[model samples]
Target: MSKSELDEIINRSLELRKKYHELELTHHGSHWSVEEDALAFLTDAGLVGRNIMSQQERWPKAHSASELEHKIGESIWWLIVLADRSGMDVKAALENFLSKTEKLLDQ
Candidate 1:
């Protein structure tokens, strides 16, 4: 995807996260802490892994493809939200990681 497209996705993800934060405040009296957010992301990540295992017949319980797709998307969204919560520029972090990994592998 283009840089602009990625930026737009990041912007929208944060915007939606802000809305969720507000909802949490309204319902629970406070937004989730960073650790809480990380745990939530981990929960979804585990579900993604479980879904993959099910597809491989390693997991006893099965989840539909659509369910797995939704979890995958949610996992990515959670990562974006988590980065923002941690005061990170997700795009820059990703670029740096890719550049460093590529250079390391090339060496």
Candidate 2:
């Protein structure tokens, strides 16, 4: 995808996240630290993982391919949110990671 596409996705995710936090505070009586958000992200990841395993086994309630794709996107949203909160430019960080891994593989 293009940078614009990535930017759109990240921007939307941040917007929705802000709304979600407000809902949590107003309706759920929630006051979550960054650490708590991280843990919840992990839980979402686990759900995605379980769906993958279940699909591999052809079991009931397994995520359809589209659902699985959406779940992966959701996990990425969490990563972006966490990275941005930590004052990192996640797109640049991803590019840096790719550069390092590519060089290591070429060595």
Deviation from native of the Cα of residue 48 in model 1, angstroms: 0.7
TM-score of 2: 0.87
lDDT scores for all predictions?
A: 0.93, 0.87
Where does candidate 2 clash, by residue pair? none
lDDT of each residue in 1-59, candidate 1, tens digit only = 99999999999999998999999999999999999999999999999999999988988
Question: Ten consecutive residues with minimal summed lDDT in candidate 1?
Answer: 55-64
In model 2, what is the error at residue 75, expressed in angstroms? 0.4
lDDT, residue 36, candidate 1: 92
In order of appearance, the predictions have TM-scores of 0.94, 0.87
